[model samples]
Target chain A: MKISLNKKILDKNEECAMQNSEFFADNDILCLNVISSPGSGKTTILSQTIRDLTGEIKIAVIEGDIRTDIDAKKIRAAGASAVQIETKGSCHLSAQQVTGALMAIPAAGMDVIFIENVGNLVCPSDFVLGEDLRVVVLSVPEGDDKPIKYPGTFAKADVILINKIDLIDYIDFSLERVIADIRVVNDKAEILQLSATTGEGMENWYNWLRSKITQ
Target chain B: MHETMVAQSIFESIQQLTNEHNARAVEATISCGQFNPINDEVLNFAFDLIAKGTPCEGMKLNIKHIPLSASCKQCGVRFDYDVYKPGCPDCNSMEFDFKEDAPLLLEEIELEPN
Candidate 1:
């Protein structure tokens, strides 16, 4: 017998993502999903962002990693309620995992919630965690051709952060080329260059976050 | 790998369809966009692992890769863009909307009557 079952394989994940989106909207919380390759300084940028926005806005974090709670601990030390989701060996955090993490953290009174997805340019782009904005970070050391190589992630990004700008003089990273390449795939995404370590160009990032919250 | 998760979802859907029809699945056909970033070889491997001891055991997995099509915003030319370099070929515009297409889809299933 031939069975015609034209269904979406990711329908389950999409359902959970929609539920999470509704929850975030009902609570008036701006949720951001931060994704990047490993060693792209996502945790450092997140920690610094947390510290910078601590007094101004209530913040929380759900850290997704394949192993260890190190990043979650850092987020906690940065003075925000943090939940660490260790995915065992999974490369990305699914919407179901984000929903589970949301129950552990206090949702109300939080102006912003950041879901730091697993460090991967490929798999993480496929999963939507019901975030208001999807941010992808590419550090200066990772070269400017990343957007071309990993178009899926860059195309889905609401904001693209070129981090570690302080190392540009030492490395061969070109901001112009990176922006041009990113524009090819994602013209609508806001591109901002920042050095999370040196705090340079971070004010724009902060302002962007604030504007999102206000909107 | 995330392919494992995707394969599991595919297997589950196949199992449900087979059960609903009271038939044994012989094969399943899946379609994915070129930009989906899934390796078909890895997905088949994962499917085998997840199908063990099930009715779908040893079932063949057929995957059809669909090219990404988009219209150039500036030139209004609709063309199939390469997944690696998704820029508009004629106008070289990166700002274009992707044509409506499913990223991953279970298009059909072949089954043996019980």
Candidate 2:
């Protein structure tokens, strides 16, 4: 006999994510899920944002890594509380794991919470961590055709940050072509070009982020 | 690949349902959306590897790859998304949203009483 079991495959994760979302809502927190490939400057962006917004907004981060707490240490040094989750080998951060981190974090009076997802463009796109916004970072060296190659990842982003723009003059990268490609892949994503190293065009990113957080 | 994790999640759900019904699964049907970014062969391989040595061993798996259906934000026309260029077919506008009823679904399971 055929059993009609019309159920979501990632039901467990979805349920956990729902709970996490509600928790954030009740706490009046704005959560951003930061996703990118390795060396896409996710850590640098977070550190800069934390330092820039210090004393103005109370921020914290949930750092997901493959095996080490190095990123978590960096986040703490940036003046925000951080909870490190070592996935051991998992390519993505699941909603369940985020829920655990949420419990571990002292979230009181926090205006913003950033979940620095494991450094992968593809895998993390499938997993939702109950975030208010999905921020995707694509560096200049990664190529202009990346949106076409990882359409799913680009399409899911609420904000697509084009990082390492300081080297754009030296590298064989076309900013215009990348912007057009991103528009094709995701018309809704707010694309920002910045260099974390030089802090060029970072104020736009800061303003965009500030617009999202209430109070 | 995260297909291993996807397969494990699918099997966990199957295992739970099988136990609830007190039956052995013969086959399972799942639907995956185009935007989910899962490879069919890798998903099957991972599922099989995880199901091996378990009661779910030898269970047949069927996957339905679902394409994206998008609606034009400008002209209000609905069309299937083109992988090459996902803009609205009628208005040629890039501002469009796709319908993803669910990214992944375990539709049906064929089972037999032991």
Best by TM-score: 1
Q: By DockQ, who's the top model here?
A: 1
Please give, for residues A1-215, the per-residue lDDT of candidate 1 as tens digits.
77777788888998999999999999999999999999999989989988887789999999999999999999999889999999999899999999999989997779999999999998998888889999999999999889998888888899999999999999987788899888777778999999999999999999999999999
Error of 2 at A138 (Å): 1.0
Query: Interface RMSD value for candidate 2, one decimal?
Result: 2.1
The worst-scoring run of ten residues by lDDT in candidate 2 chain A lies at: A178-187
Candidate 2 positional error at A54, Å: 0.9
The predictions' CA RMSDs to the true structure, in order, are 1.9, 2.4
Candidate 2 regions exceeding 4 Å error are: B71-79, B84-97
lDDT of 2 by residue, A7-89 (tens): 88888888889989998999999999999889999999999989988989899999999999999999999999999999999
Can you give the lDDT of residue B38 in candidate 1? Answer: 67
List DockQ, one per candidate, in order.
0.68, 0.64
- Distance from true location, Cα of A136 in model 2, Å: 0.5
